[model samples]
Target: MEMDVVAASELQRGGWDVVVIGSGFGSLFFLHSYLKRHPDHRILVLEWGASHSRQWQVDHQTNSAVDYQTTISNHGEKDWNFSIGLGGGTNCWQGMTARMHPHDFELKSRYGVGLDWPISYDDIAEYYDLAETVMNVAGAPDAGKVFPRSAPFPQQQHHLSRTERLIKADRPDTFFAAPQAKLTSNVGTRGACCNNGTCSLCPTGARFYAIEDMADIWEAPNLTICTGARVREIDFSGPIAKAVLFESEGREYRAEADLIVLGANGIHSPFILQQSGILGGDPGSYLGEKMLTFVEIMLDGMDHFDGGTATTGFELSYIDGEFRSRHGAVQYWTNNSFLWGGLRLDPPGRHRQVFPIGITVEDLLYKENAVVDTGNKYPVIEHSGFSDYAMKGLDFAISKIPEVFSSLPIESVELRRVLPTADHIHGSLRMGDDPTTSVVDSSQLHHHLRNLLVVGTSVFPTTSWAVPSLTCAAMSLKVGATI
Candidate 1:
């Protein structure tokens, strides 16, 4: 079946059974699962930007053309780094996929800090398996029971680069092969990983991009994807969502649906809710509050950049422990690519010897650090400074790196606090048991509007010290089962 790409102007009014607001991992996986159960139902997906194929990305030398606005806050100016095309950020992701540690869900109980997630790891563990299989995850067999997987990975782990091997050989307990969404063997139409370090722009379609992974569903007769459709407002009457009003090519259009699912990114999801005037009373008070992201610290070391997947190894030993009571949980990983382009080191071989290691610190959610509409076309980010706990975790993680890599004969180690570029934004429109403190319930439905479901990391109550794509995918699949 060929996927129909229709213009917003062409869509007939008031016929859709379900309307998905974004084409990212969350929306794509929701469509994939929902269509499997409700195959003949009328489904429509509205994407804000144009679709780009792998070939198109290669030819254009860019993954997305959507203009994402910068987030301004006390933390200073920063790019949200979200792609707004058919596949959304999956098109530009580095492919690292790991489940949030079980402890991440029960933060309040264990650490006496942060809010507990309404759902636990046990509730969504199977969904994680389903998502990993769909993404063709390649992970270490020896990853142990740290994340508590019921089944092994779908494919064998990718071979570690020489640098990764050295680090693992020295600290086997601390270092393990990082689980990634890229394939290790041929899987249906998708090809195997070709060891091309540039996963952000994978030419072989080996890495899992939502557009490629859900190609079959996108091509299904039941689904219709509308590109360049900028959803301006979600019109509602009482508790029911009536229609979605959007703009395309300078013309306004409306498409009605029985149910609406908002899978837009964290920033945009809340922004849309606010714009639509369906965010309950005091929208800004809780809807866009408590924005969270990982704080990264870079460590430069010697003889380490042996190119492979960008992130081939990670240290999970520090993910949780007594340290959590005082500071945030920490996780570190080695970067396989020497991406410092155009900068010529004074000495020739120094560039090859410099490897970047990143330490991720869990950010505490604060009401002051938030996303506000402020009458701007895009949301204004009023980010707060890092908590004392996060800073302590960063300092602790930096000090431990030298000991963990002591056997590598590292020559020079430089520690610098890099800007928040992990792109794992969370906590806007968070889900909680209380309606006053949260925007959505455990089922990810809007507390006020029962028909509206908001999937993705935006519903996360806390930020864990891991990549959030896999967890977001799992959450989408779980929501699909309910609907």
Candidate 2:
């Protein structure tokens, strides 16, 4: 049955089997995985934005969403509501897909800074393989062995651009293979990437957005996708989530289900939890804290040497305990190269016409400063500390850019401002073995509500260097199978 878009107040209690909030890759993966495993279970997903088509571009960009309110962080309307329409962030993502390493799961025990995950790398290795297969990553293997390995990526990394090749030869150690969601060959229902490099607003779905991948599941008999809807909170009676309150088209609706999956992104998921008044009153609370994102900055004067995949490979030289990179996670993509992705900073004067190579650092959000309810629709994120780490990583990466491009003037290298956005933001309503500390369990079940579960980066305890979409999808699959 097709998902019916309704207002938050009008929804009949107990109307759904599983009610999923959010349309990003997290929700898409969970919905796909659920319907794949249990055909009889009815799954309803709610997205705040429109369908993933060119008409939905909020900023006239191809695949980007254009119709939402602008915020302080990302410049345009593309930075709309945290959770919108069918694809979620996957709709606007640059498609740099990779799995979180084993070490990432144990950052707290090994590094003694953050908390260790309830699960480990061994638990999700195969799922990474499965995720890559699903995403259809194109690239050659990391010959230098930078990222942890389990199986060969479904497709080798995409070919580097001519400028990228030159930079690699000029500084072989500085550059790595670019992993992307675009296919080199037909995988599942998608085709090869057209290499327009206009992937951000891919006019065509060839780039493998999760929504496009889930098109089949949308057609499936068991799953229903409800778009143009916004989930306000999970309605709980005592400890059990009996329904969800949401609004759409200036109206209200409620949905009740045996199982409720919260796939809202890292920010909004916690906003919903706190707003529901289910999990509150814990300042030192492990739940709704410790969110992570790769803090990225664009070097101002670095030559725009090239373009292609948004992310090449990353370096782990900073991963070891002795590395003075920072207490939180930090990995540098080869953004110093021209057009190869070091400049993602949108300067105040250059928003309409310039693109910079952006250097992204997997900055860990310290438990000290993370998302907390400020009694608003969104969580108040303390970003001062993480901002500092991002600057440090940008400095480190910029210092080496000239080594790869001697033609580019070193002194002319202008370090521009940083962008406060993240494609991999995870960790809000984290899952754990205990409800006292976590909002959900290992099975993705809500701690207080037996029926309510969340599957997304929000459930992650520690943010890893790899993109969270694949891991989030993997966990969602595990959860969906149970339903």
Candidate 3:
């Protein structure tokens, strides 16, 4: 299993029903669904990083479960950390899951801003159901009118932290609900979530870590997973992606497959496609553009509340297109008063300190805004100009800060640093019916390459208030069904 391809004597050949490029949530979900539905199918999953849960080693250049001193990406010996391991980023993600609002699917037509998704919320609602079931999501029923669903949530939602309750009591206008990912009870093979506070690295393994979930599916006779396999390029015999080229233990190898899926996150997905020449005139043209990272504003202040996690509750009043509905919905994340609540405070004659309050809004970015350029094999971001409207929306988000946490007796609340924040990158290969404006179609089939499908958030036209894992999982389910 730990064969080095670059050092192999013969060009190895293996066949599979499907070969997945990355092991992120998108990849895991799709593979799970595929194996579940078509148990006869053969799945070969190649992860570039080492197997974190079962490995004694960890990567140094890039922080992966794999214990490697060098970086996995082609950009250089050091650059970004795209998890090439078994569980992918989910191994280290804060398990915050929410579905994209209906409007997010129709961003272009609704606001005349970006391109529209070929599919709509109606098309993928069931997949959301599947995601919730698998993750054992502890979210309340659909009290929010915006997310209209025919069926009640499978399980009851979670309870708000004590800090969240206080914040809501102070800011009645802002509603707070227990986030949906960490569970109040167990769903299936996954265990009940013990509020370890370290949900990002839930050592107890109770939280819905996708790697753990998928590992169970691997027990099925048809599925096979290879860790420490870093995919360098997606090989295509014409438009159809024939094989995925990857490296393991200082050597390169290729896994030929009938179908291929790219679940690499926003940063690395485009990097792989560009390296493979998929962006030239057809799918490639729209491959690396139309990028959207939610504009995140981190405001800090002092509060007496317990310093726990930063994000606990959220407000959707801004999302239904209310006060600034015309501008689109804004999301709010609550910080632990001691932690997030005090990130901005000038400590009592204090030394410097920083806390990440977790509340966030899903604001839009200009489509033609930026590109990921690898210079000297190092990822260099070339950001485009921010639209005036985007700036105004950001300002609006800032102006309404006091409405959420009035208790934070702020000595002085100042902007820390406005930056692009997205756990999931989207829109490089947007989905649409036409080839001119998009890269993939409703089925996630690339517009130009009929047989090639680009999975994950790369198909999103705009960022949404919801975390993308659920949405991306739902979309991949739909894609797998068609394939």
Candidate 4:
């Protein structure tokens, strides 16, 4: 299937009903929901990267032609990672679909910590189910027991790993099969996961790639996709975003729109607003994410790599409770990536001994951490570091290492140094009711500029202890319903 890509020069006389910047899950899901409610509306999507097809990505063993470092100026110790192509982060995500717990929405109210989201989990619960079905999310049957859901998952649960099974046997209420966007069964051209361990570029196309799965919006008669079009800033005076100023093939162009959606990732979306001089409540302030950590444990007797996919089960044991009153919450994604995987088992019976658990600690966004534009194409990413709250969560999580895997005779649990980036960025242009505090409204529309909406994790006031993909999609889907 050929993408209906429009050339930049052919459409110099630009005018569109809706002009969305960035072609990520936030953008596609918003468009997917919007077009469903109001069909045949003119929509134009501006993506910074070219359309690198799925086959090309698998064949070349990469996602994009552009290097990630080349696009941004890094002034901090850590690196911010995200795919820049048409499908955006979906190209590189591990496909762990999760919903923010009810407490995540009311941090300040429930725990006297961070800001509370104007909306609650109950508001977007329907859309979470909608997105799950659209992606054919194969989740545990009892996931609804953990997080409140109105509907069951579209597909059945993935088989839990041996270590996970043992952990669940010991702590059944705390540990459960993780909800992922891979397939237990095939649907259309997409195949079931073959447990290749490399899900970033799924050779079987089992994971939900935006280009393949989100074709409802991409191939709609109402939408036009323009690749290699980098939006510089919005042309707006006070409340209205009149036009989008962008560059394509060394030439700058202005595309007028009735409504403009800034679906750019967490960092760039605020940078775009800052460059455009819309700085109420500091759209460039408080830019950071929950710190990413990996905790690995060597099992004794359990032969582990039996999951249907890479990361099969999840542990919500440390996610909530009174600890959140002081320290941030923590969540776990049990991964199958060992330092020495199935390839080289030096010992005769050391086939599946290494059990790696991916961990994320909830964080408080600091005013010092921010994204600033220094008159460059990309914004400079600078950070002070993680707050004491987040560090304490990590410390607490590490303290529970022996207990987390106590079912098995735990040999050792090591805290490998924190990874550079989890690709879960947040808290730039956050949502709230007050214009002096929040940049966007509860509906994700700008407080002052009502016509301009900022979608994706950029509007996330607080980062939860899970991947931001599913939450961001739910927020975008809600935006679509309101608009």
Candidate 5:
């Protein structure tokens, strides 16, 4: 099918009803749901990176880098590993689609740490159902109770790999098939997962990426997508965003819209607000503050090197319960595929049995940790050290390594500390009930600017110990319906 995307030069000279920046899951899902209600409304989508097809992504490994100027301090000189293409990080995500635990929404009320979300799990439960159906989620029916789903998954669970089965056989309650966005059977134009084990670059399009899923939306008569349009700033007139200034092909252009939505991930969204001078004083203080991410811990013990998706099963018993009182929640999963190709295992025959169990600890939000623009060429991400709660959680998770892996028959389990990378960067433009504490309201709209809305994980008040794409999609859908 031909995509109905145009260049900035070909854009029509008229104001759009809505201008959505970025083509990630949040933006696409909002457009998909919003257009269904109001099909004749004029909508324009602005994407910074150029589009890439599945064949092209496979041929290129989907690693073609873009030259956007952004940096991370206290970690590295380079910027966070964020995708800029049409689908953004969905092009490279692991496809885990777990929902945030109910306790995650009430962090402050339940655990006396972090801030509680303006909305609860019950508020977004229907949207999660819609997002799961649209993404064709596949998972075991047993996970329904633990995940608190409103409806059954659209697709049946994929078969567990031998490694996952082995782990589950030993510890039944500790492991279950992970809820993933990848399809198990053919759905519309997308095919079933071929189990090539390269989900980051799936050639078959079995995985659900927003760029591929938004093809029908792009073809809609009411929508227009402009690729390679890098938004520099939102020209605000008083409290409303009057126009979006962008650069394409080394030339600058402007697009006017009555309503503007920022779906440009966590980092860039605040950076854009700072560039536009909208974030200052109280809002600016909280703009890039309270950043959160997980500390990755790798374990060696299972045999999971066969052909399968990136992750088939996960452990969630430790994420909540009495653990939150002392430390944050901890989540672990079995890595089904060996993406690191060049690692040598101890002994010759141990390579097949040396699988990795990935552990992720929930991060507490801190006001001091922030992304700052020092009037330099690039934005500086000044992140402070992890909070005491987060450290306690990491330490607790580390202490449980021996007992958790004792069920499986393995030689030894090792812990390796990798360089910290910002995988799930959130809370730069967080949403809350109070304008003094958050940048946006519960509906994800700016408190001062009524017509400007911020979607995606950037608006998350707290980062739960789960993959955030599903939650982001749900929030976008809720906001779309409200609009």
Candidate 6:
């Protein structure tokens, strides 16, 4: 491998410039930008999961060699889904890549709901374009006009279904093509979307896998990658971080670095920080998201799965409104999978009946809903439930959903059961201008330890209805370039 990977035992103490925990989107994107600025800097990446190749995943029909449930001990009713392998969440993420609305940054200031992010949309807009280009994001040509993109998506969006075309004809601006990393057109070694209905382990490498596109960053000679290494804690003294203590292959090892970057997702990152007793603030708190699913019965026999990708439509008709003040705003994603997400078997003869939609609601952080450290790789989920704001948002969205499609075909909408988990974890280490209310700063730097940075969605100040991977990647690029 060109990326100079090594075993954890090969790690030397106090000899690295930067030590990045986890080899997911956040870590790789940061390294991609950071290495461009400081080419000769020695880097070390420690991943908790096995290094399974793309072909291995396809053949095995699973993302990781490590079973996610076995990795985390969940005592609560909520289930948090994430991959614990070389590519991290990138191996298992649905390809949706929507940006946070411009107003999302100033939720507290503008909408009087949720906390405002320390950074503004203008501050990271360019980085969003950069992240999209790197991932070869296929999206609507007119996508993100309200969010206000400086540049268009790298690839044109896939063809919408016939029914969706009619829906767009009514209000083209409300519903835009889903911004996704799945290639609509081929790019170098990456192939176009085969639309085979299986995306997590795409058969033709259509979906954006960090391993395929970011191999250069992984194989860089200065960078050393160590898989099957789970970071347990950060070793810091007063105001400076010294090293990371991790477990690998039944043995505990210490890897020291001048700077430490914790990108181990919302749950694990906070667990490590809390265990270390870092001076910034509480690392593991407010860990929950609102998730619900619904099925729309197309009375006129309209086809639903004709879109090019799994999730082809984003229901923007209900999101980003004045309703966010009292209750949270919801993100509705049209599930375009006839085989998996959008099928009604019970109502036999009528095959093309459901226009399946998945809903994600924004929730204010609750201290009670948290992860407690059990000194194991698995975190104890103390999540009670979604906030009343989130529940209210769901109620409002469910009520308005029928009206959204009211202009289209006549059908009976069946509100499905509320999902136990959205699988997208948020708010373990919040970022803000004030250290009193946050764990990291707008720059993603630790207030107490300047040499330490908490990257990824874990540092999110407020959870938005948007999928966090895109914004997380943008934040990685922004802070990665500067540091």
* Candidate number with greatest lDDT: 4
> Which lDDT tens digits does candidate 6 get at residues 147-210?
7887989899988877677777876888778889999888887789888778888877778898
Best-to-worst TM-score order:
4, 6, 1, 5, 3, 2
Count of steric clashes across candidates, in order: 0, 42, 24, 0, 0, 2
Tell me the spans in candidate 4 whose CA falls farther than 4 Å from its real position. 12-14, 339-348
Question: What Cα-based lDDT does every candidate model obtain?
Answer: 0.77, 0.59, 0.58, 0.84, 0.75, 0.81
Q: Which residue runs of candidate 5 sit more than 4 Å off their true CA positions?
A: 63-65, 68-79, 169-171, 280-308, 341-345
TM-score of 4: 0.97
Instruction: Provide the global lDDT of candidate 5 against the true structure.
Output: 0.75
TM-score list, all predictions:
0.91, 0.78, 0.79, 0.97, 0.91, 0.96
After aligning candidate 2 to the native by TM-score, how far in Å is the CA of 95 from where it should be? 0.4
Q: Give the clash count for model 5.
A: 0
Worst 10 residues of 1 by lDDT: 287-296
Please identify which of the two predictions, 3 or 4, would achieve the higher lDDT against the true structure: 4
Which structure among the candidates has the greatest TM-score?
4
Please give the distance, in angstroms, between residue 132's alpha carbon in candidate 4 and its true position after superposition: 0.4
Cα deviation of 352 in candidate 1 (Å)?
4.0
Expressed as tens digits, the lDDT of each residue in 226-308 for candidate 4 is 98898888999767889999899999988999999999888878888888888888887888888888776766765677776
TM-score for candidate 6, residues paired by index: 0.96
lDDT tens readout by residue for model 2, 92-180: 77677655666777766776655678887667666666677777767557633655567787776656644456556664653566566
Which RMSD does model 1 reach against the true structure? Answer: 3.2
Give the per-residue lDDT of model 1 (tens digit) for 244-275.
Answer: 88889999988888889998888777778888
In the predicted model 6, the residue pairs found to clash are 2-219, 3-219
Ranking by lDDT: 4, 6, 1, 5, 2, 3
- Candidates 1 and 6 compared: the better one by TM-score is 6
